[model samples]
Target: MSTHDVKHRLRQLRGLPERVRALEAEVQENRQLNRRIAELTDIVTELLIPLEARDRDKVAEILERYKQGL
Candidate 1:
């Protein structure tokens, strides 16, 4: 093609790597966030089990341990 077209294409190609890096970083961040959500969900479900059983002592103990962990 023409020189101008070639230069434009070259600039676009050079930008591709930076864009890919940003996208990859976003994907990794999303994975970490998803994992955290899953962990919290598990903890909540565990807490619910004791509550559903009307186990006040177990629930309190779990809450205290969880608070200390934070």
Candidate 2:
């Protein structure tokens, strides 16, 4: 290969580690957001049963727990 091509590739390689670290941080943030969404989904699912049954106490309790979690 030409020296110019070799030098270009080397420059790109030097930047890869920083790019990888930025991507890792983005992935970590996405994971945490996904986990929070799952938890909220579970809480909503749990709340639905009590709400359908017209059980005020159970609904209140579930809401209290959800609030405390936040």
Q: Estimated TM-score per prediction? A: 0.61, 0.61
What TM-score does prediction 1 earn?
A: 0.61
lDDT minimum window of 10 residues, candidate 2:
46-55
- Candidate 2 local accuracy as lDDT? 0.83
In model 1, residue pairs whose N, Cα or C atoms come closer than 3 Å (at least 3 residues apart or on different chains), thus clashing, are none
Judge candidate 1 against the unseen true structure and give its global Cα lDDT, from 0 to 1. 0.83
- What's the CA error at residue 31 for candidate 2, in Å? 2.0
Give one clash count per candidate, in the order shown.
Answer: 0, 0
Pairs with backbone N, CA or C atoms under 3 Å apart (clashes), candidate 2? none
lDDT of 2 by residue, 17-39 (tens): 99999999999999899888988
Q: RMSD per prediction, one decimal?
A: 3.3, 3.4
